[model samples]
Target: MKLRTLLIAALLAMPAAVTHAAEPIEGNWKTASGATAAIAKCGGGFCITLKTGKHAGKRIGQMNGAGTDYSGSITDPETDKTYSGSGTVTGSSLRMKGCVLAVLCKSQTWTRL
Candidate 1:
């Protein structure tokens, strides 16, 4: 009976372990413009907090960004707007996407740096 209980407990814990083992998005990525953006995990998702710009050598403030609970966003710096988005870590790539205003924006894939 004790062995059976132990087995059941282990089985129940497996899913949680797997979920916790999921990879986090915390690295540098190149934008479509060839600019580098720093991504990090936040609010159960990920966010872009920095980007390459004219002031590349200057210290810029953090990017006020947010993403979904299991996804992230790639913002357009020029527009100062963010689309709804999510991301997945696959191999050496961070696949992301965002919905445009009243439009279905395609996934924007970024390679991990």
Candidate 2:
């Protein structure tokens, strides 16, 4: 009975452990444009905080979903506009893109710092 109880407790704890697992993109990275951003868990998902450049001290983007590839929206501090955003991390490189009005867009490759 004790062995069975232990197995049940382990099973119950598994989901919580997985829930707090870190995303592959979690860390500080430097964008091609020389901006530094820190990506980490936020708002039940992930948020990117601009740690350098013009947007410093801002949460410029957020990814509410999980996976190696993340999709969400980001804000442009320059224009105070929000747009569709997505990112994929490959090794120490992060490819990020954001689209404005579903027509105009921009992309950049960021290096892990």
Candidate 3:
């Protein structure tokens, strides 16, 4: 009976583990500019930090949302400019966009690392 209870407890914990693993955006990415970035949970949202290249160690973005889409802001480390941004995750790729006044926008596709 104890063995059966242990097995049931382990089974009950599986879904929670799967749910945590389902966050597709929480990982390292290879940016379009040949840089590496890391996205991880920070506070109530997620933070994007540069892990490699010229802008290494810079915190460049913050996003909030669930599932495949997120909205937030992105910063250009070279110019120190911030733009309204959004990100969409599709499989091992993420399409990130930044806009000025929602009119002029630029996007880049970053691949998972």
Candidate 4:
């Protein structure tokens, strides 16, 4: 009876565990320019920062969304400009776009490192 109770308890707890689980992007990743960054949970969103390379110790962006699609802002530390950015993550790949003045924009594909 004890064994059956334990099994049932474990099964029932699985859903709750999954519901509070972290997103797939909650880990370290690398950008196309060979810059490394870490993505971690920040409230209802994710905070991404450059961990090494020329953009070292800088936060390049913060994304708000779920699954593989996210919308947020990308900041250029050099220009001190922040743009409306959107990105999609496919497998180990991430494609991001940032724009200023609506028409002037740039995009890059970052690989997971």
Q: What lDDT score belongs to each candidate, Candidate 1 first?
A: 0.59, 0.88, 0.95, 0.84
Give the better candidate number (1 or 4) by lDDT.
4
lDDT tens per residue, model 3, 1-113: 99999999999999999876746788999999999999999999999999999999999999999899999999988999999999999999999999999999999999999
- In candidate 3, position 72 carries an lDDT of 99
Q: What's the number of clashes in each of the models?
A: 3, 0, 0, 0
lDDT for model 1, please: 0.59
Looking at candidate 2, the ten consecutive residues that score lowest on lDDT are: 59-68
Q: Predictions ranked by lDDT, top down?
A: 3, 2, 4, 1
Highest-lDDT candidate: 3
RMSD versus native structure for model 2: 3.9
lDDT of 3 at 61: 98
Worst 10 residues of 4 by lDDT: 24-33
Give lDDT tens digits, candidate 4, residues 4-109: 9999999999999999987766677777677788888787788888898877889878899988898888897677789999888898888888988769989988
TM-score of each: 0.55, 0.75, 0.91, 0.84
Q: What is candidate 1's CA lDDT for residue 29?
A: 70
Q: Which sections of candidate 2 miss by over 4 Å? A: 1-21
Q: TM-score winner between 2 and 3, please give it.
A: 3
Name the Cα RMSD for model 1. Answer: 6.6
Error of 3 at 6 (Å): 4.3
